[model samples]
Target: MSGQLEKIRGLKYIGVVELASQAARILAEIGTTQDRGTVSEMPDERTLRYYLAEGLLSPATEKQGTASVFGYLHLLQLLVVKKLQSEHLPIRKIKELVDGRTERELERLLGLDAKAGAKNEALSYLEKLLTSPSASSPRSQQFNSPAADMMRPVAPAHAARQSAPQQQGQATWARVEIEPGLELHVRGDYAPPTETKGVRRLTRLLLNALEGYRGNMRK
Candidate 1:
């Protein structure tokens, strides 16, 4: 479990401030900052301490003399937690989701790699969020069997509408189609999750909310 974090390759040990800064730089570089004309929520040193205390994050990978040092994976972990929080997920749920997740999994979840900037992979990931619902064929047996009766894309819109506590007063939207011409609107400064699990989680929330709609239309 602790083996993957033992070595960070290039970085020997980074103080808490440096760790947060590096994470911020990565977020900014990935274009999460440019989208809203400001940087997204970044965990500061104090927030990092709180996360570590709550076990939401892994321990620092290494140490330098008397100072504890963090690895690259630590940086990735911070970003992952931040992304999950942006979705309004509770810390307990976020902790559950990220616990024991490997370095590769973390980077993939964030849709980043060493080649991202050159390849514009971040932009590509954004595109995926828009098209993921449409890419999956709606289950033919929807509402037929319990297992198949889940949210199926009927008319996922290009954008959704909802207000947010994250970015107050700024209208945000995440559109998920529940049925044709009927869509779920999540308003806030919303950025669609770039990972599959996050997408599924949101889909389930939308699906549950539409239960009344389904029940009413029962034939």
Candidate 2:
């Protein structure tokens, strides 16, 4: 009907006005700089143009250079190293923090263990792997191959696998799973059981419980 159409049009106009007001308020707070003058006032086309030119309003981009390119885990490791450095912990202490079972476990311990034993274990493994003869060169040692650089130990694949099941199970539980027969009857891909009638019933039950609890508390 014409009346219904007019009501819908009025709603749409109200929504557009609300959105424009919010955007204008946001722009007014964060004043822009332009060629004419610094915008301590409300934004217009000029302020938007200046922001685009300065790359200040550009879309998010990926982090580049050594840290990110090496590995995300390595970047996290570097952050941990920096924190340890600030605390004035020695190299051996820093290594222990990295190799510890947990951060909490390391924080409890005060004494430094034997550094020679740790270094020797690491050196022995590296020596065997590096000195092994390759098909390309009989005399040359493969100490610093590209493959070695890429061979940083990944987190246990099982850890990643365990997280995926828990996340998916949570999503599944939260969703309303309808039977195919009822789904067809509702004429939608998925139909929620919490319809108007169900909601009214739930609201009544909640109100009744609240009133009963209040009466009991007063007594």
Q: Find the candidate with the highest TM-score and give its number.
A: 1
Write one digit per residue (lDDT tens) for candidate 1, span 111-166.
55444543555566566645555444456433222122223221222122222234
Q: Which stretches of candidate 2 lie over 4 Å from their true place?
A: 1-69, 100-219
Extract clashing residue pairs from model 2. Answer: none
> Which sections of candidate 1 miss by over 4 Å?
1-9, 33-40, 113-219
- Candidate 2 lDDT over residue span 1-219, tens digit each: 223222322221112223234335433333322334322333343543343243222211233442112222222233334345445666555654554233222222211123354465467556754553222243332332222212321233224435674442222111111211111111111223368998888668756975696569646
Model 2 TM-score (2 dp): 0.16
How high is the lDDT of residue 119 in model 2?
Answer: 67
